[model samples]
Target: MSTSLKIYDTTLRDGTQGEGISFSVTDKLLIAQKLDQFGVDYIEGGFPGSNPRDISFFAEAKKLKLTHAKLAAFGATRRAGVKPEEDAQLRTLIESEMPVLTIVGKTWLMHVHEILRTTPEENLAMIEDSVRYLVAQGREVIYDAEHFFDGYLDNSDYALRTLEAAARGGASNLTLCETNGGKLVPEVHKIAAAAVARFGRDKVGVHCHNDSGLGVAVTLAGVDAGASLVQGTMNGYGERVGNANLVTLLPNLFLKMGRTANCAKNLKELRDLSLFFDELANLRPNPKAPFVGQSAFAHKGGLHANAAQKVARSYEHIDPALVGNRTRVLVSDMAGRTSLTLKARELGIELDERLPAMKGLIDELKEREFRGYEYEAADASFRLLIAKWLGQQKTFFDVENYRVIIERHNNQIWSEATVKLTVNGEAMHTVAEASGPVGALDKALRLALAKAYPQLQTMSLRDYKVRILESNQGAGSRTRVLIESGNGKKIWGTVGVSDNIIDASWEALRDSVEYMLMQS
Candidate 1:
């Protein structure tokens, strides 16, 4: 068998099926180009003629000059009884001018009869005619035998017939889909081998869902059975649980399974690509998600940190740097000096391992922990604190006084804020308005220092999160604020804890600005 495998990505199409996952036309085009950069074989542009957004996305996507990855327009076979050429969906697929058109057709007889409202033979005819029509139109077709696993389990002979029909119609590939994601690895192994026996090994593909949390396992098992194409989405964003997570799957296939694919040559971009898509969709990157997640290579336990520092593979599966991620030693209750030193080293802190100050730092961290401050999720703040302790930190400006006024009038809420600050003994005051006191205060602070730092033009607050810490004095409870700031090229999180939410936000906001300046 050839070691080469074809990687088909459905992030733009099937990925949007995931709840709260959406991409604008521009976002779709950018992702397509990134996918091309990542060296995937194909990127499905979504089902054209189904919605205005998809239609617009295909138009813009076709304009991008991709280096790798074929642009594929997705659609179903012609309606129950219609010519593929005259059908609007198929016609739109052709008009999109994508290099390929991926068409799904009924495979399970139950779907053919019940959902499609057509006889089993008619459904077969639809598959054959649609693939043939697209082929005749000079478009490469990948026939998706949707529900193939379930269909094969219910009616093996009929499911095999569907693949044969698509093959006769000139489909370049026949993909077996675990539609409901209910198939286990053993079932995938068995059914995929049968698919190869019936349709030959050259063109069989595997597409799976994550309902059973075994999408990647099942896909690998199918590959073991000689299926050459792996269909999935980045981070497994799809309907229900999700599609197989390409973030985890691709690295495994290349490093462990030794499967040759385009992306294998560019493993370094894997983590960046995964986070890029998540940020674009305004979704929080899953901390516990497989290979590309934040926690993938994070070590918290003292023993694990010690062993990992000496020999990384002791606690890590691979050198995280190979995938554009680094081993992160987290500071937690289970952490020791090793963890602190590892984390401090990341921020360029050169605290001596044997120094007595090491224990003092640890004590300080524990005291802060008791004060409702968490550093695990806010490294930027931790770094700033470390810099301050080492006397390496700089203060560009000092806040002397700040006030915010919020009131309701004319049935609309209004807020204004003022800040008094000093830079190098010179005093300055600025005022601004926003929908909320935090925004107004942030604006006021920035306006005050706008003249001192112009690079601030490139940065913006990405997200703001607030949580109330439990206290015996309920009315005087303290709050913790976490602010995510991004400079278009990178993002960092800072933390603040105080009795007043405004004070907490200001602390985080100040740290965020200081962190960015320190980098600049």
Candidate 2:
């Protein structure tokens, strides 16, 4: 196996094939820049000939002063009868002016005969001619043998011949693509090993999808079989169960497998890069994702938390800080005093387990959890509860009363809220209107308190999530509201639960404001 592997990222091109995943020209350019900064060897921009958006992206991407990473333009092999120079797609690849050209050609004889309706000889000619033409045009060609694994299974001789054809055409690398994403690790290792033996390790690569949930596994298998280049997308964004997840694969390679890459120096930035992609994609981050997820190092069980607090390695496989994540102690009904103490320490609070109040705090926390208050994601609310129970919290203000009104006028619905609150023995009243009741309430509360606390101006609701508990009760089910608030530099979560959704939301909203005041 190679000591160092080339990391080729196709998130902008192949990842867009995923449902609900699309990037504007600017988004693609931003991702390319980030990938370069993260030490990627190659960033595959979209197919320039396929879409105007991708063509525009390449035009704009050329303006970027990338520190690392060569841009690769993706396209298919030339049409069966067309000369490479006259092929429109090949010409577009040249016009994109990317440093590298990735051409995907059919490896499966079935696809050659049926999909292209061309003879086997012509198919081989197409692969060789397209690569030879691109190489002659001053482009470094990486030929992707699409469906290479399936083709090798059906006709090993023809599949090997396809790779040889690309090799004969001056291609720098031959990437075996598990396009269908159905091959298991063993077979993938066997086929990839054979390719490595034939083409040499430096000239072999692997591209895999996750249909069988083996994308990452098979990618590792390929590396074990001596493939030197690994092709994947971040967060596994691709069509039908997605592609190999580089976010997961990189750690396995550099950390677990003892391999090296240029990006290994920035391994700690993995989580931030993952989050940046999620933000640009306008998708929620997966809390359960491995290595970088919120829950990746979270300890909830009393025994687990206790052991983890005593010895970090007792429960954790690796140091969370190695990947820019931290150990999280989740306090729940199952938590012991040790878990509570660890959680308090996580919040920068010192709690003595010997104190009689410690047991009381644990009991109160369990009782709150029984009432459907989850603190795992609502650290602010839990901190407030601790402060109140310890008799150290000061009341910033008292809510006298609040009311919301929803009315339909001129065929448009509007919501209005009135908030009455007392700050330092002085009563203040404010009214605000918005498109929804929650928005109106938020505006009204801010208006009422803005004068008393100027910091309230910086605080705004970032996210609001509502969950219905006890489905059998239907409309009367208890609602849990979790609100996330931020003040430019800091963010916190607060949670509330009640039979009435409005009341639950108000509880969470109130807690958010109180937590901010407490910290301030």
The best candidate by TM-score is: 2
TM-score of each: 0.88, 0.98
RMSD (CA, angstroms), candidate 2 = 1.3
In terms of lDDT, the poorest run of 10 residues in model 2 is 352-361
TM-score of 2: 0.98
Global lDDT of each candidate: 0.89, 0.93
lDDT of 1 at 212: 95
Clashing pairs counted in every model = 0, 0
Model 2: residue 440 alpha-carbon error in angstroms: 2.0
Every model's Cα RMSD, please? 3.2, 1.3
Error of 1 at 237 (Å): 2.2
